[model samples]
Target: MTGRKVIGLREAVAAHVRPGATVYLGNFGAQLFAVGHEIIRQRRTGLHLVIGSGGILLDQLLGAGVLASATFGHCWSPVGPGPTWNFRRAAESGERPVTLYELSLGLLTAALTAGAWDVPFMPVPGLPGTGYTDENWPNGRTSRVDSVFGAADVVAAIVPDVAFVHVDQADADGNGVIPGPLGETLVAAQAARAVVLVAEEVVDTGTARRAGIAVPGLLTSAVVHRPGAVAPDGAIGRYERDVAAYERYVARAATPDGFADWLAGHVTGGRDA
Candidate 1:
């Protein structure tokens, strides 16, 4: 069906996402800033975010105070390899509102894999003495499971209510191409209850097929035509990562007042990306 699932970003988010919903954002590098910004703008509360590499995108959402909890592999700036001030502050503060569940990239991917497979949990390497198992730094997502070979550490499945994925090109039916590193995006997309395919360009089915469809139409729930959706993060072969933008954001968001002002000027003001 043509344009059956095609919709605006605002409409798609409003339709699929509700307060306190679990949302998976994007790939390791090609983060969906547009969708994150929209979620912030709408002031959606009590969200449980699942991200591959949280980075500044997750930092923005956390700073906006819209998240009740978050599960991520890591959160930082790749540009300067700088700290995400909001995330750092939240983590360090005793009264931080959000609950954090951190895991290794391997474990996170395994969790998504479990979800995709509709399984109970997935076994991973046991880090018995690490902070992951420490009571003081409890992650609350790990456990031991008895198997044929003995006991194994397992990560719980992570099935998000909705997943927003960035793609280079997409068709009307939601089939798309994702170039470069796949990361956890493919599994996260499959694991999600609904997949919103955000594309830099919308082309014909033949074109998308020729480009090699990474996200099948049958697996996609919606398609949003958002060019430069991953700005500041960049799309492979389309643009380079905006280092200045990252640096400026990191500098401006160092303080609470600075972050508020930056949010006002960039996200909540008028600019979408």
Candidate 2:
């Protein structure tokens, strides 16, 4: 294997992501804590994070003060109906003061789809009179356009500067196989200017090809071998999501002091801890 595409996590993040860049993170089955940890360790600031669903990983970035703004379908913990504490505090109290752009799942998917297709905007039906569309509509990013079909509501394309995804397996060439749900990972990978994949294991090219590549090598800029990269969150067949850890986090991260301690111990001190 040439291993030209394989790189370390730190190098990948430093090379691909810059401060104040718009970043897309692959959530659901491909959520990556490892990449999030590295981003925090490097102390990147003013990042505009975009995720289909903002889960615990997104919370980490928010708590660390890495984000200047966020665009997401939802922001909640995987364990409960409660909102992520950091996100809530930021939005409600202006503690960290992050700009918010909320969209529905369908709109988020459509935006990424438009981005992947390299289109200026994507029309989404049945969203004309919604409250979200009325209140938080992206002014310059979207506009009402009349087409051959008719006038429809559309969202602007979201081509992120870089996308970070954790997959089940990949090859040295950067082709990846995701054994479970694709979620928005595939579209995010295709839409971003660069993609960095963190894999549980790196296999041969033939193996990756045979397994069926969900993310093609051409779209991937770098691949890092990181087993249990999404720990505290599941990776489908690899392991179950650490519900216990998440519960602990939710409990501790509810307060400022508790979150600082948790960050010092787990994130700032050591990633594995």
Candidate 3:
């Protein structure tokens, strides 16, 4: 859709996402904390999150029991050696655990690429020994294929029900200009059935075009103007990553009670809290 009206974060998320939906949360660094927090606040449950790299936001979803499953190449805080405590706890605990699908970074990218290309699968080399080539893999999403070269493993395409992206700016037409690294945001946006772009600013179409629009308006279902939405995670040149906030989150989210307290005092209290 073109010339889309900018909407509130809550409204955009509520209108686009549904319970038990398979959702893609854009790139690792450009992850939309505002969207994630809104989903939590709205108590949207049974979500299956697809991410390239799972970080604090994914941990929040896991801790809140909003996720039915998670598919990712890896899970860890960008800050340090500390693991994502909630994800770790959920995976390790026998209680109501979130189903984990661990795939290589290459495979994850291949899946998105295949989806973007509207293909059934994308072949990748050197996946035969990764243990994912077997049918026993949790979801049986990968399989071996014979090629002219030899046998190769191909990952099934993953088209999320909805995708959320955070960008530096966008136009009222929903064309987004995402500065810095491209990462997986573009592919995820294209692969999803619907897309929500949360931008720092909504500018004129000419401004967005001149700024080098990375995501076209045709792929965007909605645009949300949310300044500093990706806080605790940098938005390239717009702001620096909040290391202290991330550290605080890690410390507070280390336990269930601590996570609850942090959620109540910080996330649920609004971004400024």
Candidate 4:
């Protein structure tokens, strides 16, 4: 129970998270994503969410009232119009219900790559002149530059704690293969101090040793075995969307009281508030 060990998903949820931790989760839909909703439900951990692109689950986080702060690459969800209402309200009311870190998805990924490689910052494309090739950016807070980057801020993009990914497969030795939503999750995984992987299946460590493993060997700290666990509307083939459920959740999310109710019944699965 000390070093790296394979654990049940709920156990993984309760154990590793601390109150002030930033978590990077990789997914495109429900089938190939970690059960992050459950993870949030079972714990009181304050979180700074770093999402590559938004999804239904992201809205669930905002509705749940437990999310501390958040940053993301995009807010385009296949299901519920991203978290526009949730975000718009939070931004306007200055509620601080969730803190917003604005950076494009592409830039965020590059920063993670640089952070993982131990470089000062990744040299990606975009931005020119002044700091990070400034070339006159809006208020000017850019610190680095490259071909695929402009006004990059590594401090905003780096994951300080762990990235929890739900992968298609993993070796017993904790090498994860996220064939679906790679999303520079490998970089996120490598840069973080630890990676908590929930793999769909555990294959032989020796056979799959050099195959599609994304995160390098040394970076992973633990593997939690949740063979079929995935996020809602996160991935494609692993699981399909429950469309009826999504429709109902949307109406409930329309107002604050409605959202609270929706969070209770749908997102939290009628669990205690």
Winner by lDDT: 1
Cα lDDT of model 4 by residue, 1-273, tens digit: 123456666676666667777777764333223456665566555787777765555666765655687666555345644344565566577556577665555667776776677765654555444333443221132354435433543332374477787676676677777666576677778778777777767777654465577754466667777655653443445655556655666656668888876666644673422
lDDT of the structure predicted as candidate 4: 0.61
Q: Write the per-residue lDDT of candidate 3 for residues 1-273, one digit (tens) a residue.
A: 235467788888788779999999877556677788888888899998998767888888898888999988677888875678898897788874788887776777788889999999988775445466543442666778887888876888989999988789888878999887777778889899998888888898889989999999899988988898888788777888888888888989888999999988877777432
Which runs in model 1 stand beyond 4 Å of their true positions? 128-130, 133-138
Pick by TM-score: which candidate is best?
Answer: 1
Kindly report which residue pairs in candidate 1 clash with one another.
none
Rank by lDDT, descending?
1, 2, 3, 4
**What are the Cα lDDT values of the candidates?**
0.90, 0.82, 0.82, 0.61
Clashes of each: 0, 0, 1, 24
TM-score of 4: 0.77
Which whole-number lDDT from 0 to 100 does residue 40 have in model 3?
A: 88
Looking at model 3, which ten-residue stretch has the lowest summed lDDT? 129-138
Please give the ranking of all candidate structures by TM-score, highest first, separated by commas. Answer: 1, 2, 3, 4
On residues 37-60, what C-alpha lDDT tens digit does candidate 1 reach at each position?
999888899999999889999999
Please give the RMSD to the true structure for each candidate, in Å: 1.8, 2.1, 2.7, 5.1
Output the lDDT of residue 129, model 3. Answer: 53
Better of 1 and 3 by TM-score: 1
Query: Candidate 3, 86: how far from true, in Å?
Result: 0.6
**Could you tell me how far off, in angstroms, the CA of residue 235 lies in candidate 2 after the best superposition?**
0.7
- lDDT agreement of model 3 with the native: 0.82
